[model samples]
Target: MDFWEADELAAHRATARAWAEANIEPHWAEEQHRTGCHQTMELHARLARDGILAAGWPAEYGGSDVDPAFAQAIFDECAERDLHVDGWTTTSMVLHTIAHTGTEAQKHEYIPAALRGEILIALGYSEPDSGSDAAAAKTTAVRDGDTWVINGQKMFTSTAQVCSHIFVLTRTNPDVPKHKGLSLFLVPTSAPGYDLQPIHTLGGQVTNATFFTDVRVPGSALIGEPDGGWNVMRVALIYERGVSSPSRIEKTLAEDLASWAREARRPDGTTVLDDPLVAERIGRIAVDEEVGRLLGRWTNWQAAKGGIPGVEGSMRKLFFTEAEQRHFSDALDILGAEGLLAPEAPGAPAGGAFEHGFRAAVVTTVYGGTSEILRDIIAQRHLGLPRNRPGG
Candidate 1:
């Protein structure tokens, strides 16, 4: 598909650039790199009030109702400026799914609230034993009178500490097969009997481990249908991977690497970027960033035309994440001994962003879906190949 932005989109891009320049705090990028915290809800609310956060949603739902290309331009601009838009993007995707499949009452109640940036939703698909094997989820939700009683634990749930609600998957019937008996529910974080514990990672981000002991919600909390959460989750997963932009991580690393290469002098007073090898490495990373952008545009085009991203989304997710890891690894190699310094050290390069990135990149390959799983989908579904065996 032709993925170039059109004239109207270019106009939108200009507007986005100006808005970002005027409003984005000067220290926001450095703060995000150092603390791993995006702007607060007050900042989010300001963006929402200015119609930036709801750029792609329909007008009736408090969005701009702009074309998908326009939305892509906005995302590109945000990435170019080194902004953290993942939390906002994920919330919008979940809101879109609700608009498409939710009951009228659900849309009336949640869509406006989400667009207003009043409610932050956390995804609850992963469990201690069911990370990639989401179908093996054992979280149970039993019907009692007019409510569902949930009892299970969810692990590696990002942003659960600050979210208002959780879009969770639970097994409604055990007699059914692994993928058959699951159901999706919108559980309020304030619900009685729900407990959350933060999981600190090597990279310093805080994900969560949540336990539900007789957590009860009304039957209205169910989304789509009972014993059908697998399908709902499949749809949500497609949106998650497809709408994701590589700009945040890629831009942050690229700009940092360039700045460091320009400033760090060799033993003979030669700068790193002046080295042919360093130039080649940066060129390759730039190419990967361009390709990832095109892949994202293609995914958006498909969605705009009423088709799901399918295998293409997996390809983009796998390629871009791996590219991010490779880009930073090359930076570390260029820095040599200086790269080993921790962020807390007195004179570390880029405040140890590369060091943190290396550890974080290891987790990226495993999260969402592993590179191995994405490769399997590409072969089986995209290439129409018979499943590979040990020696096949």
Candidate 2:
């Protein structure tokens, strides 16, 4: 592992930092943290207009096609600034999958719009019945004359509320096995018979439950072969779980917690940062943050070298998310009763960021994949362990 940075990446980092400083409004962070409202289309248009949205994508698809390290730098910088780039990350992951596995027509139809941030897509993988057991999806799509009619429900769709399209996985052939019968479709959210309802969580963010009542799409909507969606989705999930780095929330929380620790005063006239135990906790968190950053950078490097991010992605996600949860849990302990104060309360530390973070951290362990499921993948796929039998 080379602990070195390339000159081009360094330049991109400088450019991204400058752009963010100038364009990322000061109020945007507070607004997003308080309301969980990310600048989706506006941010996309800005990034695209500035030629920074899909930096690693090929120039043919309206991307700069720069080094993959530049992509990592872009994400790192965004995280540093507390910018929510989940939508952009999701778009890039799907677009890259299409570029790799999609038909030329599919590429031509979706890539440009995706790069421009004009077309928003939501991931329709998790189901009400299948949370960690993503392969257990029961949504069905039956082929008709020139269209596929989909009927099922997807839960925990993060941006289904605003997204124009959904990349869904459905059982194309129920007679086949669980993973084999699956296929992926790019269904329009505005299509007739589709309904989306927001599921409010303790976390500030609003995920959705999307129901499809005979939603129909043309044959062209199919990303790959019929009943081969599992394969396509597997690739996409790998990219989803692996390629993207740690959540920016983690970094923002870390920085905020560090700042709070330095000055947070107890009723006993003792500042938290001065206490040895508190200092050690802060040190530990900082160390974990560094480790997460390094692991993410390595994953990016491997991808740039044409390597698949297999266990590395799982490792990063698992470690970073757990670290994030720990960071907030520590913050709550440090704040004691005051930590319970909501963001709206007066004199709340950093506007009750820790309180909000604690709630949001709960979903991190569940989303993408639960820690339990991720451990299973690491064991079965990465460690070559035997798959666990039921109740084993």
Candidate 3:
């Protein structure tokens, strides 16, 4: 796939980089101190207000009507600097899903405000029992005249505590097959019977276990048809699984390790990079980063051509996340005992970010879709293999 950078895209990337440095980077310290890697919507609002949040969307939706790659530029710049954009990304996924499946009234109520970053929405799909098998979700939303009463628990609701609403996948008609019986709802966090308990991961990010006990929302909260959540969820998952933006984490990590290795001297007066094994590990990381980058850009190219990635997206996610885990582990081995140090600790390599990243990388293979699941998709769709799962 040809991903040659055009002049316009290059210029847009420059502008996005400058904007991020001026506005977002300043809040990094304070935001980290306050939330420990959880974004509080301050930066998100600023991005929306400044028109960087949805630059690829139509003008009526507060965007510049440019190629999505323009927006992807901003996302990539932020990621390179270690900025958190999960809240923005997840909210945008929900927003786009709503724009496609929601009614005029629903659009009028939520879309504009969301495009302006007036609110944040979290995803409530996974449960204690249904991790990757999202259709198996047991969260129920029963119709009650003009309202829908929601009652169930959601696991790994990543940004639930900071979000104003949650786009929940609920079981609306259990008498039918699991996938056909599911429905979607936008539940306000202020409603009674909606609760969340923060779950801090080893990766230094905050997620939530959200509980819904008789929570009631208006009928207008339903997205798409009553029992058509699977279709709605498919749209959302496309965004999640697709390569919407570039991530330079492995590249950045390799650069940092290389810098450290260049100066690190052994007792024999040889630098760490001079060691054959260390050099070999760094080489492997660099190769993985480049391969992952090309895979992502290829998928992005497919999207630009109006194709929704199926096996291609799964392949990108699978390779990128798995490579990320390996890169972090390799970084730690290169740093030796110094890798064990936490952020701000004395003499910690890469200021302990790599150590934190190593912990965080463990979850990458599990979220979005597991490595095992992605393998299934690639096998069945790309290789024409027999369906392995029940519904497939």
The top-ranked prediction according to TM-score is 3
What Cα-based lDDT does every candidate model obtain?
A: 0.77, 0.78, 0.81
Q: For candidate 2, write residues 1-392 as lDDT tens digits.
A: 77554443566668667777776667666666665644455555776776666666677776765554555566566667666766666667788788778999899889988877778788899998886767788999999999999999999887777787899989899886788888889988889999988787778887789999999999999998998887797778778778765332236555677788778787788888788887788778878887887777777668777677877888888988898889889889877888999888998887777898799888887888778878988998888998887633
Better of 2 and 3 by TM-score: 3
> Residue 390 CA error for candidate 2 (Å)?
6.1
Candidate 1's displacement at residue 312, Å, is 0.5
TM-score versus the correct structure, for each prediction: 0.89, 0.91, 0.92
lDDT by residue for model 3 (1-392), tens: 55554433575778778877777756574465347555647778777777766666666665655455566677677676667777776887787677777887887788777778887888999999998899999999999999999999999998787888999999999999888999999999999999999888777788999999999999999999999999999878877787534443234666778999999988899999999999889888888887887787777777657566767889989998899999988888888888899876888877678888898899989989999998988888899999896664
- RMSD to the hidden true structure, all candidates: 3.1, 2.6, 2.3
Clash count (model 1, backbone only): 0
> What is the C-alpha local distance difference test score of candidate 1?
0.77
Q: Best candidate per lDDT, number?
A: 3
